[model samples]
Structure formats: structure tokens, C-alpha cells
Target: MDPQLQHSVAESVATVVISHPEKRNAMTAAMWRALPPLLGELADDPAVRVLVLTGEGGTFCAGADISTLRGSPQEAQGLAVRAEEALAAFPKPTLAAIGGHCVGGGAQLAAACDLRFAEEGALFGVTPAKLGIVYPSSSTRRLVSLVGPATAKYLLFSGELIDAERALRTGLVDEVLPAGGLGKRVAEFARVLVSRSQLTQAAAKEFADGRTDRDAHWAAQARASGDTAEGVAAFLERRQPRFGWSVPTSG
Candidate 1:
């Protein structure tokens, strides 16, 4: 089938599947351009409490389709950076459910997500060096933050693929599932995310991403939101808290 991004929402979880199986789900230029707007729609949807990004079939993205680079590598890279930034900025919790190869631009997208769960045999790499192209600074810093300077340098400098075990050891992946188990685990975790307090998740996402200026704003929100009270009451009453707070919509 043609390259595309297929998405659906169920039980407050939005799953975006990258489809380009012929090329191991390599993202084309148009696919990169399409990602941000799609994410914007999902971010604005009240029903979407979480997002899971994964590839169609067994493999995650192999990277950008190299043929798309013939016109202008810079433009292609720019689209990728924009897509990556959009994923990073998505308001709700975002998870990458990875399997097979997650390389080059694929790794960039995975790193942008809040968490990554990879299958046992999944392989990951950041491959700009292999093509003599410079990886974007923001991507580089994000990679360093996830895996530290030395490990990031090793991946960047060598363009070598690492297995899921190594990736988990280096903090590149939050969990490594056995083959055939990724989907079940991701769905289970996503349900847990959906059941939590959105007010807390949104604020924590921003803070974890290094935004310290929202202290007063989050404090005001917390005071106004009834989530804390509900949580306390639920604890005392021996029941699950029904959190009603959601991320504020932008005008």
C-alpha cells in the first residue's frame, strides 16, 4: 500500500500508525509534512487522553525514504524536525510502541515521544552520519538527554544499530517487551494513562520537558481543579477517582 499515516481513537487512546511497509514504513516527505497537522487535530480532541505512535505491521519506520531527499535534503530535514517538534509538544501523554527497525528519522520521532516501549528484537539507530548529513541540534540534545552524551555520541558517530536490550539499558526505551506482546502492553499502559488526572499529566509533561515558568499557572489550575479533592475522597472511600480535568484548548 501507499505510504500514509493511519489513526484511530478508542477508549481515549489515539493510535497513529505509520504505513509504508514496502520500505519498512519509511516516512516519505509528504508523510512528514502531514504529521504535525494530524497531531494538532488529535491534541485538540477532548476524547484523546493519550497517543501511541507505531508502525504498520512488524517494523516501525526505517527512516525517511531516501528518494525523497534527492530534491533537497535540507527541506526534508526541516519537515522532519517540525514533525518531531510537534510530537514532542503534543499536550497529552505520547508513547512510541516500537518494533523491528527504528532508525534514522524513526528514532527521532521515538525520542520525541514521552515514553518508548520496544519489542525484544527491535533495532534503533540515528543515522545522519551514514549519509554525511548533520543531525538537527534539537534532536541531538533530546537524544543526549535520553541516553546521555557518551551513548548519544556513539550512536551519532557510528550510525550503528543497537538492540532493544541495549536501548533499555541506556534509557532509550522505557520497557522492552517480548515479541508479539508490544500491542497488549501498550494498550494496557494507555488505559492507565487515560484513567489518571489530565491536569497532573499535562503539568508534569511540561515540567519534565524543562518548562519552569508554568509554576503559577499550574498552581492556579490545581487549586481550581477538583482532582486533588476527588483523589483524596476516593482514597478514603476505597473507590477509583474519576478525574474530570483536561488540557485547556488553545484559542
Candidate 2:
């Protein structure tokens, strides 16, 4: 059976699962093609506060399915880059809930996300060296920005997997959880995100993602949104803040 990208939503968080556990959830070409539209749908939804990417089975993605990897190299690479960019550019927060092996393209995907959480025993690698292919520049830069150039070279040059503790030490993953704790921690963090003002979060995400010149616009947006006033009122009233802001629908 072909691999699939499946998704579901609950309590303002959307979960996108990479489902091909027969090959340890390796993504097929079709799965690469499926990502952007699925992510766009979620990005356009007002109710979705955050997105979590994970695998269907115990293991996270084991990278691209080599057996089914047949297509024009340019087309295949283009599709993969497009999918990665979509995930990276998603307006809301994105997190990767990793377990087991997350290698090659899977590592690229995780790097595209804003944060990563992995189980203690999970393994991570960037394996273009093993396959005799060049890693994409964007992904390379993202990895470098996360882990620094030295560690990025260490991962890409060797193509050897590192355990979760090492991954955390190198800044590849934000949090490392015990075997059964990942899901709960991710859910809790997602809920915390859901409770924040979208206006504040979205602006902060944009700035952090390299938008260098939106000062006036962001200030105007914040003033008009009233999120600060509501937040202050809630603090003074000793009540939970109810933020009504949502991302604007993409045209």
C-alpha cells in the first residue's frame, strides 16, 4: 500500500501524521506531493492554533522510501523543497513530535518546524551523504541556524544518527521526554500556545522567522488588535484571557 499523510484536529491543535509504518513511516513521492495543500488547509482554518507533525506508528519517519523513489530528479527535489517551505512558512506555530528514527528528509521536515520534541530513545540524522546527494541549501541553512555550522556539518557529513540526548545537547530538539511522556508534553505545550494571543504569537513568529522591517505595521496591528488591553484586564481581574484574534485567511 502507498504511504499517506493523514491529519486530525482537537482542541485547537492540528496533528499531521506521516503514515507508512511498514517502512518505518518513510515518505513516498505521493506523500511529498500531499503536504502543501494539507498544510494550506490547516493554515487557512481559523480554529487551528498550532500544528504538530508526527508519525503514525512508534517510529517517526525514516526518511524517503527508497524503493518508490522514482521520478524526474528535478521534479522530485522541487516537490520536496516546496513541501518543506510550506511547513516552514506556515503562519501559526508548528512543532515536531518525534519518536524513534527521524532521518534525512524527516530531519529536514523537523528542522522546518518552530520546535521539536523527541522521545529519549529517538535518533536523528541528515543522510544525503549516505545517498550521494546534495542536501538542499534552505534545509542546510535551517539546520545550521538551529545547531550551528559545526554541528550541522557533523550531522550532514557523517550521515550517522545521534541519540535524543545528543540531539538536545546540539539544539536539534527543544525537549527530550521519556518514552511515554512525549505525547502528553506536546499536548500541554500546544494548549499553552492555544491560550496565547494570536496577534502576539503571529507577530513574534514573523519577526523570529527573519522579517526585519515590519516595525510600524506590527505596532499598528498590535494597537488595533487590543490583545494587550485584554491581557492586562485579565491579569488585573485574575481571570484567563480570552483572545479573539485569528490568522487572516490566505487568498
Candidate 3:
């Protein structure tokens, strides 16, 4: 099949599959341009409480399709950075359910997500060095935040692939599962995310991403949300809290 971002929502979890299996699921230029709008749609859907990004088959993504880099490198990199920023800014919880190779642009996208779970034996790399192209500063900063300066330098400098075990130890991935188990584990965790309060998740995400100016805004949201009351009542009454607040739609 042609390269595309295929998405579906089930049980309040939206799964976006990068489909370009012929090239190890490498993203073409068109695919990069397509991502932000697709994410916007999912982000606006009240039914979508969480999102899971993964590859179409065994491989998560092999990186950008090199053949599409015939244009100005800056133009291509700009598309990727915009897509990465969009994913990072997504209001709800987002997870990368990774398997096989996650490299270059693929690794950039995964790092944008709030969490990453990789299948054992999966390989990851930031490979712009291999092509003599400079990685974008925003992408570099995100990588540094996830795996620290030294580890980020190692990946960026060497363009070498790291195994899942090393990635987990360095904080690149939150969890590592055995082969064939990634799907089940991601589904279970996504359900857990869906059950929680979106108000709390949205606020925490904003704070964690370093937007400290929203303290009063979130405080006002909590007061108006009624989620706090429902949570307290649920604890005292021995029932699950039905959290009614949804993330406010972006203008």
C-alpha cells in the first residue's frame, strides 16, 4: 500500500499507524505534512481520551524516506519539526507503542509522545548524522530531555542504533515488553488512561511540558470541572468515578 497515516479510534483510544511497510514504514514527505491535521481531528474528538502511535506492522518506522529529500533540506526538516511539535502539544495523553526500528524522524515522533513502550529487540536511533544533515534544535532538545545530554549525544553523534534494553535504561522508553506482547500491553495501559480524568491529565501535561503560567487557569478549571467532587465521593462510596470534564477545544 502507499505511504499514509492510518488512524482508528476504539474504546476511546485513537491509534495512528504509520504505513509504508515497503520501506520499513519510512515516512514520505506527504506523510509528514499529513500528520498535524490528522492529530488535530483526533484531538478535537471528545470520544478520544488517549492516543497510541505505532507502525503498520512489526516496524514502528525506519525514518523519513530518503528519496523524498530531493527538495531543500530545510523545507523537509521544517515539515518534520511542525509534526513533532503538534504531537508534543496534543492535549490528551499520548503513547508510542513501538516495535522494530524507530529511527531518525521516527525517533523524533516517538520522543514527542508522553510515553513510549517498546517491544524487546526493537532498535532506535537518531540518524541525521548518517546523512550529514543537522538535527533540528527542537528535536534535539526533546531527545536530551528524554535520555539526558550524554546519551542524546551518543545517538546524535554516532547515528548508531540502540537496543530496547539500553533505551529503557537510558529513559528513552518507559517500558519494554516481550515480542508479541506490545499490542496487549498498550491496549491495557490505554484503557487505564481512558478511565482517568481528562482535566487532570490535560493540566499535568501542560505543566510537565514547562508551561508554568497556567496555574491559575487550571485552578479555575478544576473548580468548575466537578471532577474533584466526583473523585472524593467515589472514594468514600466505593465506586468508580465518572469524570465528566473533557479538555477544552483549542481555538
Candidate 4:
């Protein structure tokens, strides 16, 4: 069966599932290409204020298919780069609900998100070193920004998968759930995110990704925008702030 970008909605949350179980949720060039536009459509919807990316079965993602691995170094890097760009550019809050394995390109994809949660038995790695593939400088920078240089180097050099506890200790995962509870826990986390102010979420998301080249000085303006005002007002009144009520006018 072909890969699919399955989408669903609950109030302000938009859930996107990577449905390619036959391949252990491995991503393909087409799926990587499909993601940015799909996210754009969901972000454009006023009712969609948060995005949850996950795999259909127990696995989060196993990385690129070994079957479709043919490409120049630049081509492979470009494909992975675009996938990361899409996840980073998503306007609302983003979360990765991780399970079995998040390796190679899959690891890079999850790192692009604002937050990540994993099951007890999850594994993570950047296996390019073992595969004799050169890791992109941007991906290396992002990894270092998350887990620090020493740990990043260890992972890259060894290409060894780290367990859930090590991943949590290294700050790769915000929370860890029991194997059976991972899905439900991630759902709860997504719901909690959706309950908050979209504007604050967007600003915070950008701030958390401050190391990214695109998250420059304009973030200050974003944090102080009308959304912050409405959010503070709603907090004082003890009500859910009506957010994503309209599309943001471009500058």
C-alpha cells in the first residue's frame, strides 16, 4: 500500500498520522514532499490550532526506506531538509508522539517539532555514521541544539540507539509513557495544548526554536502581538480565548 498523510480534527487540534505500517512507518520522498502543503492547509483552517504527528501503528518512524535510498548526497540531503523545514514552519504548536523507533531521518523530523513524547520502549538515533551517509550540517546543528554537542557527537559517532530513559535524560522527550499508554498519553497532551491560546503557542513555539535561522528578531514582535493581549484578557476573565479566529495578515 502507498503512504498516506491521514488527517483528523478535534476542536482546535489537527492530528496527522503517517500511515505506512507495512514499512514500519518509513517515510518516502513523496510523503516528505506531501507534508508541507498538508500542514499549510491545516494551519490555514481557523479551527485547527495544534498539530500532532504520529505513526499509525506502534512505531513513530523507522526513517527513510532502504528501498528508495538511491540519490546523490545533495539530493538526499535536500529531501530531508525540506521535511524538516515543513515541520519547523508549521504556524501552530507541534508535537511528535513517538513509539518504537525514531532513527536517521526520522530522528531529524521529530527534532523539528516543538515537543516530543515517547513510549517506554522507544529508541532514537542518528545512524548516518553507520550507513556511511554524511549528516547534513543543519541537522547536526539542530541535534546539538537539543541534546548538546557531546551527546550529539556520541550518537552520530556510534550510531547506537538510545533507550527511552537516556532519551528523556538527554531532553529528547518531554515525557515518557508506558508502552500501552503511549497513545492515550499523547492524545491527552495534544488536548491540553489545544486548550490554550493559539497565539501564545505560536510565539512560544517560535521561541523554543530560537536556534533556527528563521526564528530571528521578529519573534519579539510576534510575542507582543494582539494575540498576547487577547490571551491575557481571557486569562483575567477565566475563559477560553477565541484564537485562530482569523488568518493573520501578512506583513
Q: Write the per-residue lDDT of candidate 2 for residues 1-251, one digit (tens) a residue.
A: 56899899999999999999899998888899999999999999987999999998778899888765565656666778889999999999999999999998899899999999999899999998987878889989999999999999999999999999999999999999998999999999999999988898888988888899998988988888888899999999999998766799997
Q: Alpha-carbon error at 129 in model 2, in Å?
A: 0.5
Clashing pairs in 4: none
TM-score of 3: 0.99
- Residue 222 of candidate 1: its Cα lDDT? 89
Clash count for candidate 2 is 0
| TM-score list, all predictions | 0.99, 0.97, 0.99, 0.87
lDDT of each: 0.96, 0.91, 0.95, 0.81
List candidate 4 segments past 4 Å from native: 71-73, 211-251
Tens-digit lDDT track of model 1 for 1-251 = 67999999999999999999999999999999999999999999999999999999899999999999999999999999999999999999999999999999999999999999999999999999999999999999999999999999999999999999999999999999988999999999999998889999999999999998999999999899989999999999999998878987764
Error of 2 at 96 (Å): 0.4
lDDT of 4 by residue, 8-27 (tens): 99876788888889988888
Clashing pairs in 2: none
Q: What is the lDDT of candidate 4?
A: 0.81
Task: Give the clashing pairs for model 1.
Answer: none
* Candidate 3 per-residue C-alpha lDDT over 1-251 given as tens digits, one digit per residue, 9 for 90 to 100: 68999999999999999999999999899999999999999999988999999998799999999888887787888999999999999989999999999999999999999999999989999999899999999999999999999999999999999999999999999999999999999999999999999999999999888897999999999999899999999999999999989987765
- Decoy 2 TM-score against native: 0.97
